[model samples]
Target: MLVKDMMHPAVCVTPRDTLATAVRKLAHEHIGCLPVCDGMRPVGMLTDRDIAIRATAQGRDSNEVTVREVMSVGALCCSTTDPVEKAAQLMHLSHLRRLIVLDRRAHVIGVISASDINGFLSEPRPFEVVFYKEVLDHLGHTHRSQLMRISMAHGTREEAVRAAILEFEETRRVNHWNALADGYDVVSVRSNS
Candidate 1:
């Protein structure tokens, strides 16, 4: 699979945007990070964790501080045509959840996350199933030691809970016509994943 095949459209913010504004965008979009751009050029990245550690923990006011004050100095990017495996490896090395996707001209186009890759690798399932799996993967990695200590006690219970949770997610998808309306486009499940 190619990067473009898995990347979702990028939602961006400006350097001058207040942390409050950026946080709102993050929450509204249901994304963990955003590319901070100066006009059409990508400059850096802002993540929820960045805000928490650099601003909130420091007691800086979100409404007063700008994204420029807290965003990572530079954005990591991958070409749209690059292989998905390459992107995944880069993310693993960098300990990042997502990377900015750029066109040949270096224009930011989209963002790709581990969730996207995991969804691509697995057989198609309800969105909620894939989402929960990704969440478990992230938690397991993030708290590897803690989980290992408790794994024996919770292993069977965890599996049962996961199965029950996934079973509750609606598996049926609504079908629609192949043709698009004049000004509308549909992102198929393959690409949406």
Candidate 2:
């Protein structure tokens, strides 16, 4: 499936928004990330990690900060049509857990993460079952190892694997596969040609 298929629409933040407000929204909504937009165009992304690392780490009060202050600029993104595997690979390479989905003109359309993929895996579908092997194979060694580490650290193999996979998807490196399958046929052909 493509990012557009699963990404959350109605993405909720802009650069000028205050960190305090963002935090409140996040807490209220129980979400961990936000796409920072300039009007309708996405300019960056803000996450719980950015606030903890950039603001709290510096001893700054979140209440006084702007989303721009702690937001990651030039945020990794994916096109709506990009393959799910490609998104996963990007996440792994960048060590990121969320990615903003964009449209043909580079406008923010939605966001996708490992969580979405996990949800897809849990749902019953014939196509999903068939593609499962392809999905696993696309998640390369580094990605797999990262997932294992997360699993070990977090105490749940399933959750860890999902987190790792989603993290990579969010970073824009969606080309991962299970070791057994070689790689996605389309991706391999594009890389070679």
Candidate 3:
């Protein structure tokens, strides 16, 4: 699918807008982010988290701080005609929950996030579904989270460790395992529908 096929037009703010304005939009829209734009062109992004960390935690006056002061600069954007896979890749690489979509004229058109991809995840094959879902989990959602842990009382040898790993993977798909160390080598097994 193309970005134009799935993206929704964004709610936005301007650089000159106060942080108070952005916070109000976030609450009113019940959304996490807003594209900071100048006319039709996007310049930065403001998120709910930014307000919490930059203004609230720092004890700054929201009405005095502009979006330009806390908004993240240089958003990642994909063309309207670009494939959905391209958007997924960019979001994954950038650790972003959503990406801005732009037209050929570099005008902000819409937004694409993992939630939008959920509707189009109608792949016929099981593996294809799993593939997209795994990417989406890293991109935004966390429907299933898998973790693995291994503990040894004796010597740590290569062949034995490999066998132990393989055994643990096949049987312990969710939640229980004796771990080697505290919070060491955790793995998120891909979820299936």
Query: How far is each candidate from the true structure, as Cα RMSD in Å?
Result: 17.4, 12.3, 15.6
Q: Which lDDT tens digits does candidate 3 get at residues 1-193?
A: 5689898888899999999989898888888888899999999888888888988999999999999999989988888986565576568778988888899999988888877875555332212111111124556764532343332222334433543454353344434233421222422233465
Q: Model 2: which ten-residue window has the lowest total lDDT?
A: 184-193
lDDT of candidate 1 at residue 59, scale 0 to 100: 99
Winning model by lDDT = 3
- Model 1, span 52-160: residue lDDT tens: 9999999999999999999997878898986565677678889988899999989988999888897655554222212111123644553111100000112244453
TM-score head-to-head 2 vs 3, winner = 3
**lDDT (CA) per prediction:** 0.68, 0.66, 0.69
Q: How do the residues 120-170 of candidate 2 rate in per-residue lDDT, one tens digit apiece?
A: 544432211111232235545332212221111222444434544554344
Task: Name every residue pair that clashes in candidate 1.
Answer: none
Q: Using Cα atoms with residue i matched to residue i, what is each candidate's TM-score against the true structure?
A: 0.61, 0.60, 0.61
Q: Which ten residues in a row have the lowest lDDT in candidate 3?
A: 125-134
lDDT of model 2 at position 61: 82
Between candidates 1 and 2, name the one with more favorable lDDT.
1
Model 2 residue-pair collision total = 27
Clashes within 3 Å, all models in order: 0, 27, 1
Error of 2 at 166 (Å): 22
